[model samples]
Target: MPSISHKIQPCLWFDSQAEQAARYYTGIFPGSSISSVSLYTEAGQEIHGRPPGSVMVVAFELAGCRFTALNGGPIFKFTEAVSLIINCDNQDEIDYYWHHLGEGGDPAAQQCGWLKDKYGLSWQIVPAVISDMMRDTESGKAQRVMTALLRMRKIDFAELQRAYRG
Candidate 1:
């Protein structure tokens, strides 16, 4: 019997900039690269009537997760309802992603460990200790932390920690 791999790959739909986006992602993340790029062609013109040399699909990896970007011609657009969440160990990790993803991304306030990037993609830049902080049984403490988060565009971990203690 042969063993099957259970890796789940996410496919991203883009208008015409799939390759550029893939390159940007590869540059931002370590241990990432373009796995493959495919083009579309039509049978009558060339199979499905797609123009030759048009980008069909791009397979890439970021932080070891596989994602495919399809140049689907803008039929669908991304929304903030679904986003990639990053759990940061410290302020430095948070800052790096915040600067890059938020540079052109819109900022939305979510109670604890959530933000929306410009591409309408959601991201959660959460400190590793957030779970421990939220574990506090005291409702008041949790409320205070939530309050602090509501006031932030890019979350400040130190401030959240202070709120957690108060």
Candidate 2:
């Protein structure tokens, strides 16, 4: 309905799954949408190797952040160095995102709420309170939370709460 006002937008590189990834992400987050799409023309066919009228880039938004999914012919891949973080208010939210985002993902790559999704995108599903606890270093809550967090893949919210209290 309105224009994307964000100055900086993340452009994800996909081989040929740009549209698929855009749809998958839009379906998961509320108030998200695929705002626009651009098709490749024959002008750059020799270099890009994509056919005319094929999907080239899909612009979308998640959590109010605009993103561009580019069918860049597998030139780049997602790594753990950078990830999208999803902050949840509670355990159910964590579980909900963890299940959905981690589907068909690399199980071994999952650690401390960080997961690599089916599309090779990395995501961090964490509870909001964990950050607060992790920053409460004066009370030793940060240490306890870090200890508990390091042992978890999908974060245990209740366990973190217990750690925070101790």
Candidate 3:
């Protein structure tokens, strides 16, 4: 198979924590690292107001997925509408991501395996089984799973499995 180069990458906007967020994310996931860092230049100082030589953008990879974190000032902030989904194979993976990502996060924002990380980036730490369980359209198993899923903050794979069986 030919190696596919990714054309589109998600760019995360941060007030000034692009480098910090990149470092945090690289530390959390395996096979992740900061590939490059671009500093702000004097040419755009008036509009950007950021000091020259300060971090402007950080290109990083988390678990093989490329991402760009931009220190674009406080013009915009993260919302829950867009979230990065982490599909885990089992409960252990779920717990690990939940614990790590939820640190310094808004507790109220955590629902149905969805959470806002410290940088205000939304994430869904879900189990792989949830997708299989949700695919059962013939019976009301999917509905049951959905009901069970709606009640929880962090996803419980066992509960979803039980809901699927019912």
TM-score of 2: 0.95
Which regions in candidate 1 have their CA more than 4 angstroms from the true location? 1-6, 43-50, 107-118
User: Residue by residue across 1-166, what tens digits does model 3's lDDT show?
Assistant: 4243798889999999999999999999988999889999999799999999999999999998999999999999999989999999999999999999999999999999999998899999999767888888889999999999999999999998898889
The candidate that achieves the highest lDDT relative to the unseen native structure: 3
- Compared to the true structure, candidate 3 yields what TM-score? 0.95
Report how far off residue 116 is in candidate 2 (Å): 0.6
lDDT of each: 0.76, 0.93, 0.93
> Per-prediction RMSD in angstroms?
3.5, 1.5, 2.8
TM-score of each: 0.82, 0.95, 0.95
Q: How do the residues 22-86 of candidate 1 rate in per-residue lDDT, one tens digit apiece? A: 88778877789998898987644533445787888998888878888988775788876677877
Clashes of each: 5, 0, 0
* Model 1 lDDT on a 0 to 1 scale: 0.76
The candidate 3 region of ten consecutive residues with least summed lDDT is: 1-10
The model with the greater lDDT, 1 or 2, is 2
Error of 2 at 15 (Å): 0.4
